[model samples]
Target: MTSDSESPFLQSARRTLQLEQEAVGALISRLDGDFDRACQLILKCTGRVIVTGMGKSGHIGGKIAATLASTGTPAFFVHPGEASHGDLGMITPGDIVLALSNSGETSEVTALLPLLKRMGIPLISMTGRNGSTLATHADAHLDASVVREACPLDLAPTSSTTASLALGDALAVALLEARGFTAEQFALSHPGGSLGRRLLLRVSDLMHQGDRLPQVALGSPLRDALLEITHKGLGFTCVVDGQGRLEGVYTDGDLRRTLDQYSDLHALSVDDVMTRPGKRIAPDILAAEAVRIMEDNRITALAVVDDTGHPVGALHMHDLLSSGVV
Candidate 1:
């Protein structure tokens, strides 16, 4: 009955958290035969998982569909109300329909039951009532019942929706594991995401190759090496041999130190001033691994080399950033 602003807000938040926590706990305990059967049905579905719901359940269904799609399970959301009109054509016999109805009586969702059955597509129901018409008609039922809603009126879908979301996540993770989904495969599905970049981006993809690579022969003047560095814009040049094997590297840092020791920058040879035995990586290494190598070595760039130690390409920290590998 506290009417004060702070007290009411805190009470509402606390109640909401408590209700959602209880809903999650309930869903965890209810993972029995029905939950296993639901997983089995989805695993065997060769086409996709068509999710349909109404109102608050519709919002949850959209999220569930997204999770399933991103986790290697092909799924899409269809509004049951729209399904009756024409969207139902999106579903086929190969797909399994997952219908959501909190009260098990949403007419919009219930209306699709007969059509799904006629197509021989299995129906998996997620609802609060185990004995409701939706559950009885479903090939598998997932109990998403909650003790109560966080709403004081006990009417709004607060806890029930949260439970549905958790159950959906559980199902997604289960499917992801069942399909032996690897990080590389997941990355292919999400090439624009950070995780995707970390898993799929290789050093060869971002490394400067061909004529863009900065290089200078042993005994080449420091001024010429600096020009190569400037032209390449990578702030460094590799010292190479007759066979183009890396002998050393001359960086901006090395140039600064060299300037203090010698005033004749034009006369100094790269072999005389270059840092010997510089760090290098294979062409096939991952960009993420390149980042780790740079961090551990406290360097900003790396020279990519072939098995014979020939400088093939160059990679910079900015390369990883631009590619979203870091």
Candidate 2:
């Protein structure tokens, strides 16, 4: 797809992608008892899963740790080299150690095997070799071998790392299912994310209440309702009875219709111009449900009512948008 000089590089890129794809695909058949054992070990672990690796494998291990932790498995990544230093103190007897090494013979990773054993910690090894030192010492060995690297020289940790990462994802997802990890729980782990906003945010968290709410008596002058709408900037005002129970709603749109139907604007009460029994929602509903109601009814706001049908709060489309619930 390029000029003659660039064609060779493009071909190389295509070949690399093809090789990596095959590498991940090859791991499908490799899932066996060992993979299940790895999940079991982590599930049984009362403490955190300590993931460690060297160089590029460390990068992949870090990503795997994040995936596991966010998906309900308690995990964190520590560098294998750092473990030989005072960092090994971070590992306790209750923790499980997951070591990543393409060759299964990285000196730094292998060095921790004895310390982990002395502490009575369980070991799960992901490696390219089945009989290497780390794999042989592991309680569970995940075979991550690849036929060849995407690098033409087969010297870089290309295909092997991809396969290991995929295998780690498989292990995490399996454990997630086994533990019955729910989306709400996942949202708790990621409270700063948009998914958390959708799953955990409720109507009360974003609704305007008290002095911020716009409301008027049902029998009040239309001018009084209009003043409430203009002052509150919610595009509408709730018309309520003496007991504060909602009787109707009047919005800017209703005002337009009122002007066309009545010549004497000063003579009308809010009850005559308001939409009676206006669309309302409870304060406990998910903000997402409120969004659906607004979209379905082609309206931009709703009155939040309590069990007694009294207006407690006002919600507008802008509130949802500003709160990142829309």
Candidate 3:
């Protein structure tokens, strides 16, 4: 039944996005004391922020809860209807409530107001009307009002929901800044993800250790170092002194350069072709940091050194890549 001449549908779609975009923009101009107080409350909240809403507003509330939780503010969403049916136990006196409703008069959410008040919990309501019952009962009212709904019928939650989401993001970010939340702390909470891999994984975890490290004595013949590289399968070897201090590194690139200058590979010692005082990393450094160092210097592998600059381990770009740190 669809056709190329669906001009009305296209116009409606464009209008909806435009209206939602404007609502989000309006949220910034409306922000004032209440917004600041909401952030302060969340930052000081010893317990979680319990987010509650009904229907479409509930969907937006769920995302808001996730955003707050990930950005240093501990939060979780609770369905208003379920809360009335005993999920109210989830909200405690130490917790703060974030209630979302476009009309600001959802019966399910309103029913919990007295109990929340009696328990001495703070209420932050995101609603379109400042005079609505929910707003009147709230300790802080975030204006999520839109001039009109994006729907042609003016019944859908589009613009109002967009405003609510933007305001929620603002609150979460403000709390994040007030708490001095760092990227490392955020990564700790997200330890199962790529962020965790980048922050928590160390070079020591991926670098070849003990007998597997590609290493040879400083005066070892180039052929013997090449044998070490082959045996370790890292495409390179560290050249160390008798005291285990890193003197230099020999790589496939060095082999190619040596081949161009002198055809006698067997007669050369590792010291003749090795790159001196080559790029190195500490074992405790993040693998992502190691990748950064390698990428910044345009090199493939680095010798993992100890406190006194002795080579304790070695790693290649492929090692980081395979370990999901690159």
Query: Can you give the TM-score per candidate against the true fold?
Result: 0.91, 0.91, 0.95
What RMSD, rounded to one decimal, does every model reach? 2.7, 2.5, 2.7
lDDT for each residue of candidate 2 in 208-255, tens digit (9 for 90 to 100): 999999999868998999999999999999998999899989998898
Q: How many residue pairs clash in each candidate?
A: 0, 0, 0
Which candidate gets the maximum TM-score versus the true structure? 3
Candidate 1 vs candidate 3, lDDT winner: 1
Instruction: Point out the worst 10-residue segment of candidate 3 by lDDT.
Output: 1-10
Q: Evaluate model 3: give its lDDT.
A: 0.90
lDDT of all predictions: 0.91, 0.93, 0.90
Poorest 10 consecutive residues by lDDT, candidate 2? 1-10
Tell me the tens digit of each residue's lDDT in model 3 across 140-241: 999999999997899988888888988888888888888899988898888888878888899999988899988899889898999998999988899989
* Superposition error at 265 for model 1 (Å): 5.2
In terms of TM-score, how similar is model 2 to the real structure?
A: 0.91
Candidate 1 residue spans exceeding 4 A from truth: 1-6, 193-195, 261-268
Which regions of candidate 3 are displaced past 4 Å? 1-10
